[model samples]
Target: MDLRGKYGLLIDDIAEMRTTVRIQLADSGLEKCDAARNIKEAIERLSQRRYDLIVCDYNLGQGADGQQLLELVRRRQLLPLSSAFLMITGETGYEQVSTAAEYAPDDYLIKPFTSELLRSRLERILEKKEALRPLYQVLTDKVDRAKALAICDILLAAKGRYVLDILRHKGQLLLESKRNDEALALYQGVLDQRATPWAEVGKARALAATGNEEEARQHLQRALDAYPNYLAAYDSLALLLEKTDKTAAQEVVEKALKVAPSTQRQRRLGGLALENKDYPRAESAFRRATEKDRTGFFKSHDDYAGLAKSCAEQGKIDDAFAAVKDMGNHFGRSSDLLARQAAVESLVHVKAGNPLAAKAALARALALNDDQALDPTTALEIATACFATGDAETAKGIIQSVAEDHNENETVIQLAQGVFLAAGHGEEGAVFLEATRKRMIKLNNDAVAMAKAGDLDHAIAMLTEAADRLTNNCQVSVNAALAILMDVQRNGAAPEKFSRAQTYILQARRANPEHRQLADLAKFYRKLAPPGTPIIEET
Candidate 1:
């Protein structure tokens, strides 16, 4: 308990809870403790500085929970590998989700516990982390599997109490590096030693990766049969089922939801139910998710829209409009929100036999759109409304744009197909989707050919033009930005080209801030620019 120099973060919505946890940490001899009332503030604090530990409550008011915060930190590389993250939750539902999560906190503590218990859990996690600190340090550097393997060897040779954890970590690293055969061997070795559910799941994943689908499924089923509440197993099994039997996948999702209900789980269930045209089930699940997720970062407006769609489909037009109103109330009337709400409202009006109101709503939605690039969810909602309101051309345009942007995604394609079917244009929608996808593919191919043929300027111009036309296409924008970056790099990033590259980077980010290539391009932009210069404009 000699925490002489430790500093930590405490996150909770309640002021009293923050004070209590701060006092507890201070009593543990920590030098300083920072407090955040919610995930947004917690993210700000973490970004501004580092902490030795983060004691986060499971529920942090609205817009994100502790788990989502942990994921953001991990995904964004905001935390040092040496940092210890401890989640405190009063809900038992957390156990199922935690166990199945690909990334988990160092440890979790259920609330209504004594300070002594909290300290004990913290100490144990710290000890384990310290034991594997070297391996973690190596992982943070470059993800070189050979070095990781060497470190794993050293740790395994000690044969300590954390042997199993080390083995599991090694197996995961192997999986990340695509060394599935080696990872399978590692999992098999663990299975021989102990029949742990985690090992079984890992083995199943490896088996699946090795193309032994049947064997993989058998192992997953065995794990689930033995540990009926194993959420991760259910997740994998559901994914496997999705490729062949959506009904089976829905069942698997339902079972997992029963074991541990979460906003994400409810949303997934709603989506599956909607896909199956089980309007009532989708309505119920989407309503539950939207209600419960009011204060979480993972909240999606899609849930509300889905609820509205369900209500409209089920002849509850009034409830559909109410859902739209609630969505506007909760998320505000930003252009995006307004556009989606207007679209759903139009559909609701149409369902209620009010064509004039529906037309007016559609006009409002089109006005709000103003050429903004649409996310798939919003596009689908808008398309559905357009179709319902007898605006087939607009609906087809939206669907075609979404298809061009996300043609490779089966889920989006399926959803688009469903929308077309609901609008009685299934065949036309199918043909349109295929045609748009082909056009996009050809456009991408031609751009690549231009670049490869040493027509760098032509490639850059072509994709930039495509970016304007495909305003909502993240891939097209990213390609344009990357093309500009590459051309700049070839010429030592001349000032003019650097500015153009920076402009495209900003444009791409505005289109899709989370696009994968934006980060790489941003990093390259920084290296090319003057020190401390900002590449992304504050919007």
Candidate 2:
């Protein structure tokens, strides 16, 4: 219960409220407390230092709020799992803050609360965090789920007070590791004991992962019917529906938006609506996302870029051009900015019957891609522009490059497909990306085969080259590390090889922390290396 050693942050727009809370926290033995006036200051503090606790007021000024700040920090990982967030809300915001279990704070306090009540809530959350520290360190710091899973089992076997919490973590770890049967069993076990909404949704996710999509959808529907405010259930159901029916997906998002609106959800709605050719809906969604913060932290070039495309699709050339111009005010000036703006502007000009302007814009976009391509998203955006400007070959070339570099990244691949879909080449994009994906798979397989055939050096060379070039591809990085480890396993491990292997393993972890095979690779490195090789420190 002692908060003397804990670093705390107090955020409130009103100066008097911040002073009151800081004094209260001091009275409660929390001396090391920093204060922020609003979301921007909070983010700056969080980035500069990690606080053990955060106390925030719900209604921050400038249309920003504590909940939105929490979501933003959590998404960007500015706030680690170890930190405890306590929201202070008045009666007006209690219902919305209370049922927002999707991204709820660790605990919340109603206004006019004493220091004792705040201290009690802090003690409880800190106690649970301490009990699960080992698991969190492994999962968050090392990205090793096997060790985390083992720790969860140990904690569960101890019959601890936080057994439910442990079980939830274990179930998620199971699903993430692709142990669908085990995950399903864990969820079912939890459901048998009590009908928790998370367990219900987890069970549905498990079922879907194991190829029981229909059954999963039914379970999700049932979960929604029972727990109407459970946002995760809505998101899970929406994702499933997206595979076979975009219309259903959009409808699900709409309902979720009705329940609780978020910047991420709005962007998702915009994407789905755009794909469905509902230009007005897309425009509305993207506009909301772009204008919601005005801080430019939550909104990306993608939002403005999306708004531009949505407007252009509706023959609102002026509105589309305005969006394209707005990008200059928001995102940083770089190759990415130039390319994205030009790309969207090309589409707008094309829609306005200005072929010369459209061609000029497309040329500038292509020039950026040729000289200094920054990110996959921008590359794909330029590809879309290429298609819009009647330059199919350049668009395909850009798509192919981005796809090869991000062969294992579904989000990037989908973004690439969106480019083609926007250009009336959905089927062709699907086919082209599929062929590229399969080809990459075959190449990786062939390298692995070569390693299995005792050609470790050649395999290492091929994989290392690919991994270095395609740095974003975690699968390639994993294989490269595996090839090196296989060599070390056969011949004695050299210090340099061990070091390089560790580097690749770490690289893969950074690229895709949620990669299903991450645990397997970590386990492999542990067994294949010297004692305390420090690949991933055990917590």
Candidate 3:
């Protein structure tokens, strides 16, 4: 229970508050501590080094709070699962600190507490973290769901103090592994034992994954009615609504934002509003996103692009131009950023009825956009600009390339569809993206069929070619790596072939580290390759 060896961080914007917390923490026997005055510094420290614990103030200044910081770190994997997070808040902010966090802090303490109380809270949270350390170790590491789930089972069998926590992780693993029925059973069992908000949302996710989308939506609506502050349910419901009704999805996101002002959710709202043709709403949402984090870490090219497009739609030419220009100032000059600015500027010019300027900007953007290296978001922006400038063929071609390269990425596909929707080609976009999806699926199936039919050379060639062309496609890269590993199993492991396999495997991992087939394939390679052979290092 002694904290002498532990390192901790105190995050508070007010110097006096940080000093007070530090004094208490020191009194609690934790001598090693650091202090970050704001979100930017907190993020910098977290990225630079590991901390055993973080004691953060809930009301960080500049509209960026500790909860958002927690969410950011957890999503980016900057904060390891073994590290404990304890939120310090005043009584008025206690309700918010307790609920509405997309990623919850491990514990929270009200202000005006004694050092002894602070020590007790720290000890309790650290103990829970320590108890879950085995699972976190596997979870934090690159894909090893099997080991993680096994640890869940061991912990559950022990009936430890963290049973609900263990079950939560177990359910998530089952869902991620696509063991829908088992996941459903687990969530249903948890709900039966006691009605927890996460269990209900988990059950709903399981339902949707098992092809019961309607039931999932209904369950989520009920969950929202019961636990209105649950952020995850709102997110799940909004995603589900997007499949059926974009307007309802926008409304759901709006409600979620009212509960908690999230930059990411605001961006989603802007995207949805744009789709719904609600220009003013889109502009407002995009503006919030662009202006939320004074620190540049959370600013994105898409936010500015969305703002400009929304403003242009509402005939705010000067505002639209300002947004496009502002994007250039915030982000360092890069080819991709240049392309993004030009594309957005072209759209603004076209809206202002200046065809010559629009075409000129579009041309510049196109010249800078390299299909292979351009990111999906920037590529789609260029495509949208192409559509605006009356070059449907060029836009379609660009969309096709981005769509094919990121065929399995639903977000990119949706954005590409949004471009077509804005261009008045909604039906065409739908058919085009669907065709691209099928073509990519068939490409994989054909190579898989060839490999199964004992045509190793042709199959490997096809997959390797597609993997090289579509560097962002996880499925193609996985198939290429699998084909190579299969060949290695058939013929003895040649170092060069294994090396090629390793390359494709890493490509797949980079594209999508959570690809279903990656862990098994990597494990197979490790088992087959000679000990002295260079293998893929675990990240």
Query: What lDDT does the true structure give each of the candidates?
Result: 0.80, 0.87, 0.91
Residue pairs that clash (backbone atoms under 3 angstroms), model 1: 62-295, 63-295, 63-296, 63-297, 64-296, 64-297
Tens digits of per-residue lDDT for model 3 on 256-293?
Answer: 88787878888999989998999999999999999987
Using lDDT as the measure, the top candidate is: 3
Stretches > 4 Å off in candidate 1:
11-27, 35-49, 56-82, 89-100, 110-117, 130-186, 206-215, 294-296, 406-418, 421-435, 451-457, 471-494, 502-539
Q: Which residue pairs show collisions in model 3? A: none
Q: How far is candidate 2 from the true structure (C-alpha RMSD, Å)?
A: 3.3
lDDT of 2 by residue, 312-429 (tens): 8998888999999999998779889988899889888988999999999988888888843468988888888788778899889989978988887878888888788778888998
Clashes of each: 6, 0, 0
**Per-residue C-alpha lDDT of model 1 across residues 1-539, encoded as one tens digit per residue:** 45667778898999998888877776667667888888778888999998888898987765456776787787778876678998888877367436746667888877776777777777777777788899888876544567888899899999999988888888988876778999999999878987988889989989988898889988898899899988879998988877677788889999988876677888888878877889999999998898876554556788888898889889988889889998887775577888888898888898889999999998888776557465677778888889888888988878887777665566888889879977888798788888888888788778878887888899999998887777656678777877877786675656667666666676666666646566676777766676544456444
RMSD of 1: 5.0
True-vs-predicted CA distance for residue 389, candidate 2, Å: 1.7
RMSD of 3: 2.1
Candidate 3: what lDDT?
0.91
TM-score of 2: 0.89
Structural similarity to truth (TM-score) of each candidate: 0.79, 0.89, 0.94
